[model samples]
Target: MAKSVAPGRPNQFLRNLNSKIACIPMMLTALVIFLGGTVWTVIYSFTNSKLLPRATFVGFDQYERLWAASRWIISIQNLAIYGVLCLIFSLLIGFVLAALMDQKIRFENTFRTIFLYPFALSFIVTGLVWQWVLNPEYGVQGVVRSLGWESFTFDPLYTPEIVIYGILIAGLWQGTGLVMCLMLAGLRGIDEDIWKAARVDGIPMWKTYIFIVIPMMRPVFITTLVLIASGIVKLYDLVVAQTSGGPGNASEVPAKYVYDYMFQAQNLGQGFAASTMMLLTVAIIVVPWAYLEFGGRKRV
Candidate 1:
């Protein structure tokens, strides 16, 4: 006995019915938790909530104060420097490592393990390790001085102007391995036939990679870019562990700023305002990419 379907109802809704049913809980969680929380945060950003949330709206005062604060300004500057360098170096170094690994070199597994081992460590561990490594008395500076290079100086943690760059070093070491693995996966997916064709055509290996293989890895690059960008935006733990935003707030970032305000300073509205701005920043990056990536495909 067949159960009759409703007239004019498409069967598409019933397709993968179990999968759809399974996804309902996830969808509802996203709607209720993420979307709802985002809306609540945005709403509170406009109010004068302090210690406790109050609905008393104060317009853009919180935002104005946030922008005007020197600490916030410095945090933004540090983030900008860290974000840009981290993106460029991570991609470049990762791709280079992936390319080297793709050469069928001897002991490839050993090399891959060595490169990727750091990523297994948490950021806190990475930060702490790097902090010691960069310590003036017993780190690189000390070791070099011990080797009789008495004038050599390489400490970055205590230096205010270069403190952010110190953080960048830890970030790169921990992150580059993951990026390399991702790029290697993309490289491995490339067809052997393409390489054969390029070789037969007398193309240089580098030129082939530059002109053909990289373009084919657009999806991988985009995914890597998004991952790195998100990490940069929400960066806090590394800074906290490495410098505690010290050397007088030189390594302070937006996430740290928000946390310090919301909890430490007991200023909910200011924290929410900063968080809203962070959301806006993410939206600005994501919306256009989403449109170009998906919308353009639909149009085609």
Candidate 2:
């Protein structure tokens, strides 16, 4: 009888010795920096550490104060408004623009470049440019007044009711291009045979897109959704440059609140609590989506 070889020692992690060695530094960096800092913040969030971190645990007092603040409440409301509107409009405009570009039109590259050029600029730059453009005396209002439309009041930034919408417009201008690029890439990945089949079945273009093409592009849509959602959450710089949460804090966002309480107000515990709440919110939204997308048994 042939002697059976012991399963080659079961292939240790050291088998890929060079690759594992290369990844050691990065793995340690992530664990030490990201994980360690997160843990530290979460621990301190339970304390009343003002101006600096301390071990004086207060058990939800900071969180209660955070919720009671009007500015923080306004910030959450603003974030919710901006987040919802941003996701809807960005996806709609981006997909529409992508579909148009996918129509084999002439100068497609030129159009794509023109559309995507805004994304290359930083958000601060975009916000400042829009700030000027939305200025009542020197921007769209002025130009329209110059052309003799005297009563056309379109100053969203100055109006307490619509200042957030003004910021939303600027955000869309800066971000929709990236979304379009992503959607266009997804569109390009569609198999030509699928289109042929759709045509052969006498399906209208809109129906084909709604029923089949979009479902096939689920990965791309999910990627775009995450990008937009993250941008919505971290919307501090643009609001700062554009309106500074002005018009009586109509455009205040949670990130700005975190910054103000942390650094400007010297209330570290409150800021930490707010940041922890933000993290919890993100987890609440992401965990369910992740489980639905990655978990679940297949039907027989």
Candidate 3:
């Protein structure tokens, strides 16, 4: 019987090969699309392309021109300021709201719903409403004057020096809700025994939250920060709706600048360059944060 045994068929090897072969079409499609788009963008960025793309290469001249443009420079500066202010304000307000909501007070669900519902609304609508509210002649300014506080002038949307802050205020209105939801989720996941132990040791509630609870929610905090940072990097809608980057481009941001050049100014090369710059900036900041979050975890 042993002498009569025949060679086994290569069933396992054939099956493995067949499985890999089945994935080839989809994998090729993805690779082709990704590489094709990237190559197109790179090629266009080297040319003096217009509204429609062109093939005449003009080297880095567009980039030089973009750097020299005052509006572009102002836009970059405004974005930096707005990014920092929005990030800090949203985090602080959201954290405070979450902490308050965690106190097991009356109508807890109602309070959470009220805080979170703002995030569901469109930023365009939110920006428009804020714009009306901040208008000088008929908004907060008028109301304040009528109430006998004639010195109350809240016209940052029209003030060149303080317009960026107005845009930040609108962004915060939409952004803080997201932060609140995230922080609330983190707070809810904390162990109740931690609170009991803290109370047993006579640890103050605020101290417990600031030191112990916050430290435990590091991952959530990092996640919220990253989310907020990405939003800051691509900030456009609220600024456009609320201020239109105006009162002399005081509220302009990088995304809006890129958009204007790409379409209105018919300077695709410069727009792509700005887009590339934004990508680089995001990579520079996000890579390290992501590495610490993910790579640090793997090492641990």
Candidate 4:
């Protein structure tokens, strides 16, 4: 009693068949490698895996130990301080630079290249350069002292209290250029008519930007937020190249904690647990924002 397929209807399954077939390998790799690896890491995190992964399930002992460790606690605190400051300063400075660049200034290309040059260098290079620049005896402090001020103090890498800020400086210098470019592109995408209307309405330029332009660039802001947040989460190499978590683990971040525990300390379970916590933190921040941003949209 079932009706046959309609002659006028196109077969949905066969549509884009070649493209879908071509993507099978990539899909399989993502599923088997990334997803599978994540699952494996999460599973072994609950076990007492040391030296190598084992099946000695230890319930949340690894996590409890991780939390109780003073080093881990300091790292979390440092990450929070670093993340908040980095997000704020990077966005503010980048947007300001972008807004200035959008004013049709002379030698814009030269200025942009100069501003963005730091971004072209690797984080390791940036860290090394900043380390030298921030060195008390050999860099800024020395230069200022030689100019007649002997008591000028400017070392941060060796100072436990402000070591994270030293790394933050390097991070901002290396990252702000890219953020500026992204903001510039977003600003450029804004309609000129909007500006004209604002002018005709006697609205201040700053007011127009704050009230209208920024709201329109929501997608760009979201994209930049994701990039910056991801970078903040995996901040390791810069810390290693600059301070190596020195000055009594003051500059230690979550990623470096995970790495040291996994490789140096040979505590795989503890490392995995820390990593799982990082994943959970990212999920907690990202999931709700993503749902709010896209969940209400109707799928085509």
Winning model by lDDT:
1
Q: What is the lDDT of residue 273 in candidate 4?
A: 98
Off by over 4 Å in 3: 1-39
Each candidate: what lDDT?
0.95, 0.93, 0.87, 0.93
- Tens-digit lDDT track of model 3 for 236-257: 8888889888988788888998
How far residue 171's Cα lies from its native spot in candidate 4, in Å, is 0.4
How badly does each model clash, as a count of residue pairs?
0, 0, 0, 0
Which digits, one per residue and each the tens of the lDDT, describe model 2 over residues 1-300? 123334666456557899999999999999999889888888999998888888999999999999999999999999999999999999999999999999999999999999999999999999999999999999999999999998988899999888999999999999999999999999999999999999999999999999999999999999999999999999999999999999887788899999998899898899999999999999999999988887753432
| Ten contiguous residues with the weakest lDDT in model 3 | 1-10
lDDT of 4 by residue, 90-207 (tens): 9999999999999999999998999899999999999999999998888899999999998888889889999999999999999999999999999999999999999999999999
lDDT of 1 at 238: 98
Worst 10 residues of 4 by lDDT: 1-10
In candidate 2, stretches whose alpha carbon ends up further than 4 angstroms from where it belongs are 1-9, 297-300
Model 1: residues >4 Å from true position, as ranges?
1-15
Best by TM-score: 1
Candidate 1 scores a C-alpha RMSD against the true structure in Å of 2.9
Residue pairs with colliding backbones in model 1 are none
Worst 10 residues of 1 by lDDT: 1-10
